[model samples]
Target: MQTSLATSVPSWAVGDVTVHRVDEIPLPPATGPWLLPDATPEVVAGQQWLHPDFADHEGVLRLDSHSFAFVVDGLRVLVDTGIGNGKERANPAWHNLRTDFLERLTAAGFPPESVDLVILTHLHADHVGWNTRNVNGEWVPTFPNSRYLTSRAEREFWAGYDMEEARRQMFRDSVIPVEQAGLLDTIDVPAGGVEIARGLRLIPTPGHTPGHLAVELTSRGGAALITGDCIHHPVQLAHPAVGACVDIDPRQSEATRRELLGSLAGTDTLLLGTHFAPPTAGRVVAHEDAYRLQPVPAA
Candidate 1:
């Protein structure tokens, strides 16, 4: 089946609660050097489903996808907004490109204006790109009524340390405007977790950023954890210690990755990685000594 059509199924038996994967963004190069030498480009390219001429750039570009969430509570809710429309983006490949993200969301029964809550894992450009819409030179919250939630640490870090020119653009373009419009909420990351609504909870997973978080949902005695960028590539499952160069604190990121992987593997948890390939939702399987992703079949 085609990659897009492959993920048409939303609800799946993830332990107890039903889970779904709503792809808000898509990337090309199936294999590149995102992790480290351990996850070689050759190995990633060998995957049958991966595209050959993935990204429009040289040096291992990957055709990957971005994930948001749709929780099956009594009410419909959203997790994160993938890279949105119309921006003077940095990366040549991702810049000024048009995507059908909104359409895809609508196709999956989520209209931009209908989203109940948007839980951003972090304030990164890719994660917050679709938080707002361009309305006559002003950036406004797309989900005007929906509360856009983020962690306090993440908000403070980006607000103070966005020194790089590109970063400033991301904040100025995607984040600050949301706050100005009174749609952003900075939540406390307590040990027990912060309840967004009835069943949805913002669970702190930290490390990738000062306040990186994961969303955990419990209903009908079932649960699933939406891992933001804690685990970027599947190869990380093989070597959880290798940190991404984009990580703020490599050591902390590595530690978190190891702990999260270990903890989740011990349970019947449904693991979801934002930058993982299509059908991004899956479960962990003990492989020899470590663990690997065993993606549930597409519904």
Candidate 2:
């Protein structure tokens, strides 16, 4: 059985761009404690604000896996494809999913062939799973007509990496198919980041991966930042020191988070968490020494 979109698609207005949060599987409750070990029940309890939305009253965290889709200047763009269906994965939660991801994508008005660009935040398994889909006997590029993009550093790093069999399997099915099809592209995202399309830019948010990126979209005076994997959930906003166990460079990841949060602390820039659960989009506000998200529910 496939999961259906529970409601009409949740969306946000950023100046001229209307971003949509395409539904994917909500991670299991065990995901929170495993992903962020530092965010213990005690720590979660301390933050009285996380309850009802981000965490249970018992202090269990809530996380999700989804993608952001929208059109800007006639280009249908999707940021970070979630864990794909039918892929073999080491994580039980992500293994061989059979959700109606493509159907949901088509319903969002950006069918696979209609997509103009697919921006990869990083090369992580969950983030790049939908890059390809098993077709008959082989994994093939899902978006046949779209140009796939990722930071040059990300690919190069993996090229020289001695990956575990699990990761190698992920690339063979997800990443390599896109590259082999001549659809994958590599861009040099500098410290200041680079603009790929009009009003769309990629900010270098490394440490999760050597060349991880966070997508940014600007229309008129309004702006939005998509946190690829740099910030997994809103809990990170209140506890910047709490790091994901999977971080490649925990120190660098923290620095990037702090700097990124500082820049958007008081501004009206809308922050969209790639793995954030319900009410995913928000405004970053200064709280004590760090920041907290003021959720901007879809309209």
lDDT of model 2, residue 156: 98
The true-versus-predicted C-alpha distance at residue 194 of model 1, in Å, is 2.8
Which stretch of 10 consecutive residues in model 2 shows the poorest summed lDDT? 1-10
RMSD of each: 4.3, 1.7
Query: What lDDT would each prediction earn against the true structure?
Result: 0.70, 0.91
lDDT of 2 by residue, 1-299 (tens): 12344356788999999998887789999999999999999988988877788999999999999999999988999998999999999999999999877778877777899988999999999999999998898999999999999999999999999999999999999999999899999999999989888999999999888899999999999999999999997888988888999998999899989889999999999999999888888899988777888888888
In candidate 2, stretches whose alpha carbon ends up further than 4 angstroms from where it belongs are 1-7
Misplaced by over 4 Å in model 1 are 1-18, 34-38, 41-63
lDDT of 1 by residue, 61-175 (tens): 4435465556555556677777778877777556765777766676666677787778899988778888877889888888887788899988888767837888888788888
* Number of the top-ranking candidate, with TM-score as the measure: 2
Q: Give the count of colliding residue pairs in each prediction.
A: 12, 0
C-alpha lDDT of residue 148 in model 1: 83
